[model samples]
Structure formats: structure tokens, C-alpha cells
Target chain A: MKRFAFFPGCLIPARYPAMEFAIRQVLPRLGIEIVDLEGSSCCPDPIYFKSKDKLSWLAVAARNLSLAEDLGLDVVTNCSGCTATLSEAIHLLEDDILKKKVNDRLGRIGREYKGTTRVRHIATVVRDEVGYERVRESVVRPLEGLKVAIHYGCHLLKPSKIMQVDNPDNPQVMERLVEALGATAIRHRNWYLCCGKACQTEDIPMNMMHDLLTTVKAAETDILGMICPTCFSQFDYGQMKISKKFDEVFDIPPVYYFQLLAFAQGIPYEKLGFDSQRFKPECLLRF
Target chain B: MPEDADRDEPVRVNFRFRRELAQKIEGNLASFCYQCGACVGDCPATTYSSGFNPREIMLKVLYGLEDELLGSESVLWQCTNCYNCHERCPQEVKPVEVIISLKNMLAARGIYPEVVSKIIGTFETTGRTVRITSAIDRQRAKFGLPPLPPVPMDEVRILLEPDTGTDEEE
Candidate 1:
């Protein structure tokens, strides 16, 4: 089994423990071992903390990277935001000057960044490391008739040069993954839009979420498949608020792609944490 | 010539300040922005709120209207940090990075969204953005998950300290 240090970030551990359960249940069966990233802090939230203090942001992200560096393994995160922040920090710290500055802060804590560790989102790990054919072969049960709309959350794809996860404009990797599990991945309008988690404080996030959900509803997909925990929260929990606000019932369930994978891998549905979801994925039970 | 003319024309641009802000950005990507509106067309925030245009933020940065951009309640937070602007920019303007730099400047003065302040405060204390309530712990245990590992909060505090020689605290 290929061992990796798991970086679960803040949300999955604190807010969405079910998602973590899904990841833990699924990855090991696929021959991947997850080692807990002990002593890790928040990705410090790239957008919020980076805007507040870039140096502090770098320090925190570097600190998290060092955990995996100490393990002599690359870090893999389930949250796309964590992957983005950590990857961006690695890119920034590549410069000797920036590395020295961040390292100087880290030195206070008796930690040093050797600049050796790399970060990967779980999607990239499954895509590149576990070949598609292997995923197809591993499937115990296929989601033959289910139609899934993949939400490739923003940070997973963009700032294209830095992320390098997939083609930014025409991304089919997630859709392709959906297909590998024997589901029809539908291409929907505004599927490329951000889940609007960052814009939640203001009215715009709701407006944006409403737009994306409307398009998904119009497409008539059974569920929205995504990788990031933040997107999962916004689409899964936020759906109720959006439905109430807009006075339209959007019963579409938002599910992590991994949860679906575990289900398709024939992991018991009860262990996958389907009971905790706000909008229970009853539609998926049919398969 | 006329009284209306004096009132109608806005004050002259602060060329020096504009150049200073532009220089502060690494690689001078801000100066590279030629305003083709590629970022505007692709920006999700712009599609929702007409007031949240990124190209306009770039234009404001170019014009040295720091107060206008930073003082505005909506624009900066509206950006989901999607990076479509950076990806599609023909000149590699990287409008998102410029906006982040501006936010950094504002945050140095202790100016930013209240939500950001609240979240960062929690992170500084607990080494996690959200506290691990008893209920959450119960849920983790119920799922056959191990207890959360401890965080080195003391080390986190030291790392979060304002680096010496920077008056960010003041």
C-alpha cells in the first residue's frame, strides 16, 4: 500500500466528520494508506488569512507542510482549499528569499522547512497515482444508471499554472472519474462557477449558489459530485438555506465524490455517513 | 473655463502612489494589465454583482485609488479567489494576486472583514479554525475514528507573532 500523510484541514474534522469517514473508508480499500498529519493547523484559510497576513499565512502553511516533510512523504489533502493554499505556499517558498523569510518565522517554533515536501489534492492522487483502469477494476458494484453532475470546485482547477490538476477551461477529469464508476456524468451550465463559500458573508454568495443550483436542477442530475469539503458544505447544507430563500425546493443532494466511490466500491452505506447529511442522499439508495 | 468644469473633472491621478503600489507587486504584473476586460468577462463575482468588477479593481489600483478599492465594503470579499481572471488574462495581469496584495496592505492596518478576524482569532488560540466541541468529538468517535491529535498551540502562538522590525502590531 502507498502510504501518505492525510491533511484533513479544518472543516472536514470539525464540521463534516462524515466526509473524513468516507475518505478513511474508501482510500485504504484502493491500496492507499492514510497516516494522520499530527500537529497540523488549519490551512489557515488561503483567501482570509493570506489577505490578512501573507507572511503568517506562509508560516502556517509551511508548518503544515513540515509535518509531511518529517514523514518523508508528500502531503495529500481532501479539501481543495487546503491543497491550493499549501501548493501556493510551496510555490512561493521555492524562492530562497521567501523561504528564508518564512523559515525565520518557523524557526521560532523549532521547525524548519527543507522545501522537500510536495502537496496533492486527493483528486489528483486518485487520477494520476491510481490509474483509471485500476479504479474501474476495483469497483465491486457499478452505479450504472445514476447520473452525477460533477462540481470541480474552483481552487482544484484554477490559477492553472500552480494547480496543474487538470485542464482549467475544459476539465473532464472528475467527469471521467464519475464515468469510471459506471455513472453518467452530465455536463451542466455554470458547473464551472465557484461554490460561493468565500462570498458567504455578503449577499452575493447566496445569489451565486442559487444560480448554480438552478442550473443543476435544470440539468436534472441525481446528485452533485465534488472533492472539496468547503464546496460540499455550501452545496449540501447551503442548499436548504437557498431553497428557503428562493422559495424553490431543490432536493438535489450534494455528495463527495469519494462517498460515491466508497458506495460503488460496495462499502456499506451506513459506514459512509449518509445519515448525517442534511439533504439525505436517498436518491443514491436506489442504485 | 466654467465652474461646472472644475467640479466635473475628478482630482488628478496620484502617479507616484500608483507606481509605488505597482512596484510593490512582484514581477510588476499589475503594470502589465492592459485592461482587455478578459477577467471581467470570466469573473463569477461580476456576473452576480455589477459593483464587484475585478478589472475595475485593477483600474483603481492603476489609478492609485487605494481608499476607493479598500474602503469599499463589497468588492474584495466578493472575489471567491476563483483565478479565472489570472488564467484568462492575456497579459498575465494576475488580478487576484494584486487584490490579495491590497488586502494584505489593508489588513496590516487591522482593516478587513470581521468574519476573517473572528476565524483567525480562533486559529491562533486552538491551532484549528473551529473549536472541537464535545458533540463533534462524539460524532468522530461514533464513526470509529480516533480522537483528534493535539496541536502545539504554544508553537502556533510563536509562529503567529508579528515578526520583529515590522510595526504591524502597532
Candidate 2:
């Protein structure tokens, strides 16, 4: 089995642990081992981009990268924000002058960054390593009856073009994966919309009422399968908001790809963290 | 507005691209904005909240609010950069271009928040963006879990870093 350093970023371990757990149990069956790294700080996310000093933001990310490279492990990122930030830094640190400045700062702690490691989001791993056809073959209890909508969050594909794992405007990696699970892939207009998650901190009400609502209206589906935690929250928790405001009950559930894979593998609902999700298992079994 | 511009001194803001920007990112598409209010008309970023306006900011470029626009937080940070304005623009005057240009300007001028400062400091020290810890190292502690099999970090580095390393000489 091939192994790599796994990074679930700040959100997964605490908020969306289920996605992490599902990925762990399912990937090993495909010969991929995920090594969890501790002492990792917040990827600093988008908030870092707002920083007054680029050098400082670079330093924080650099230290984290150094920790992995020093240990001689490649980074597997789950959070798009972390991947984007880290990917951008890969360019900044490669330059000789900026490299010297960044290193001088970390030199205080005996931390040296050689820029030897790489980062991969989970979706890329599924698409690249576990080819869609292989996944199709691995289906123990294929998702033969379920209709799935693929929501590729912006962070995974935004200023994110350079390190993109798949298409930017019309992505199908998730859809192909859904097909591999033996499920009916449902197409939705809002799948292209941004979850509007990052803006919540900046404009709480507008981000929800306008940005999020707009996407939900376009979703028009039974289940929303997402690759991101922030995106998942927009649909998972955001569903409650839609139900509160609208007339007819709007109850499109949110599911992780790993969960679906685990479910199809006959892994019990408990192991797949079914109880931890906002959408209940019983509610979904109707499909 | 055209007649007013003819009579009144036309206010113009000078925008310069930064060194760090990709010369080809379509970030320069702001040059296509013909002062159409379409971006102002549909932009949630412009009107979603107060003191943050992409259209008004575009007007600032026309009206020459250079220092203020570059120095303002709302213009750059407040925008979700979802490219909604770009998608909705009637004249194809991508407001996103101006936003990117403005952001690049701020980054070059070292006008961003303090966190950027700390991160740049980190980059000078180490070359990578994150740190990873092996899950199997701890046995007695609560963080301890079933020992994970050995992980391969080399391939992951290749995927994320994507030729950022110096392997050409080898």
C-alpha cells in the first residue's frame, strides 16, 4: 500500500471528523495510507490573504511545510484554502531573495525549509490514484438507486487554477466518482455556485440570505455531495435556514463522497459517521 | 456623466500590475470595463454590505480615488472574489480585474494585514506551507490511536509542490 502525509486542515479534525474517518477507512482498501500530522496550526486559510505583510503569512505556512519536508513526507491537503495558500507559497519561497528573507526569520528556531514536499487535496487522490473505473469495480453495494449532485467548492478550484485537480468551470471528477459508485448522477445548476461560506464572517446575513439561498435554489436535488467542509456547512447547516424561510419543505441532504463509498462497502452507518451528519440516515434511506 | 466629464476635470486612478502577479491571469480584464453599471447592478459584493462597492470602486478608478481605493480594506478583503460581477457584467467590464489589480497593488505596497507579515517571515525560514505529524508515534496518550501504517510523503510533495523543488540538476 502506498502512504502519504495526510492533512485534513483545521475544519475536519474538529468540525467534520466524519469525512476524515470515512476517507481513512475507505482509502486503505485501495492501498493508500493517510498519516495524520499533529501540532499543525491553522492553515491560516483565506484570512491570511488579508494580512498586511505577505512575508509573515509566508513564514507561518513555511514553518508548517518545513515540518513535513524535514520528516520527508509529502502533504495531502483536504482543505482548499490550505492547498491554495500552500501552493501559492511554493512559488514565493522558490525565489532566491524571498527564500532568504523567509529563512532568516525561521532561522531563529532552527527550522530550515528545503521546499521538497508536495500537497494534494483528497479529490485529486481519488481521481488520480483510484481511477474512476477501479472505484466502479470496488462497489460492494453500488449506490444503484441514489441520485447524487456534485458540489465542487470554489476554494478547491478558484485562485486555485494552478494547482487544480480537475476542471475549473465544468468539473466532472466528482460526477465520474458518483457514477463509479453506481449512482444516478443528478445535474444541478447551483453546483457551480460558490458556497459563500467565507463571506459569512464578513456579511453574515447577506452571505446566507442571498449568496447561499441563490445556490440552494439552483441545487434542485435530493442530496448534495461536497468536497469541502466550508461548502458542506453551507448546504448541510444552510438547509435548516431554507426550511425555516420557505413555504414547501426544502430538504436536500448533504453527503460526503467518502461516506457514500463507505456506505456502499457495507460499512455500518456508525462507522461512516452517519449520526454526526446534519442529514439523518433514516431521512436518506427514503431514497 | 459624459457631459459632466467633458466639463468637469476627469478623475482617473493609475493602476499598476504587481511583480508577483501572473502576466496572463485575465486579472487585467478591468481594462474592458466601459463604466457600465451592470456590475454595480448585480454585484452582491458591492451592495451586500456598506462601505464595500466594486462598482463605486470602479467609479473611483474613473474618478481617481487611487490612494483611498488601494488603502481601503472593503474594496479588496471584503469581496468574496466569487467573480459574480464578472459573470453578470453587461459590457464584459470585469470588475474582478480591478479587484485583482487593486489586491496586487496592495500586496506590492505591503498594505495587507499583519498576518501576511508573520507568514512572509515563516517562508524566509522554511520552504514548505504546512507541518504533518505521524499518527502512530503516540501509544499511551489519548491522542494515541491504532498505529497507522508507514506513510509516503514524497508523492504528496510532488502533487502539491509540483516541480517547486530543485531536481533538474540531479
Q: Against the true structure, whose lDDT is highest? A: 1
Which docking category, incorrect, acceptable, medium or high, applies to candidate 2?
incorrect
Residues A144-193 of candidate 1: C-alpha lDDT, one tens digit per residue? 98889889989988888888799988987898899999999998998898
Q: After superposing the true interface residues, what Cα RMSD does each candidate give?
A: 1.8, 9.1
Worst 10-residue stretch by lDDT in candidate 1 chain A? A195-204
Pairs of residues clashing in candidate 1? none
Q: Candidate 1 versus the native: TM-score? A: 0.93
Score chain A of each prediction against the true chain A by TM-score and list the results: 0.96, 0.88
Estimate the lDDT of model 2: 0.61
lDDT value, residue A229 of candidate 2: 78
Clashes of each: 0, 47
State every prediction's TM-score relative to the real structure. 0.93, 0.70
Chain A TM-score for candidate 1 is: 0.96
Where model 2 places Cα greater than 4 Å from the true spot, the runs are A48-52, A200-220, A245-248, A281-287, B1-78, B83-170
Can you list each candidate's DockQ? Answer: 0.63, 0.12
Cα RMSD, model 1: 2.9
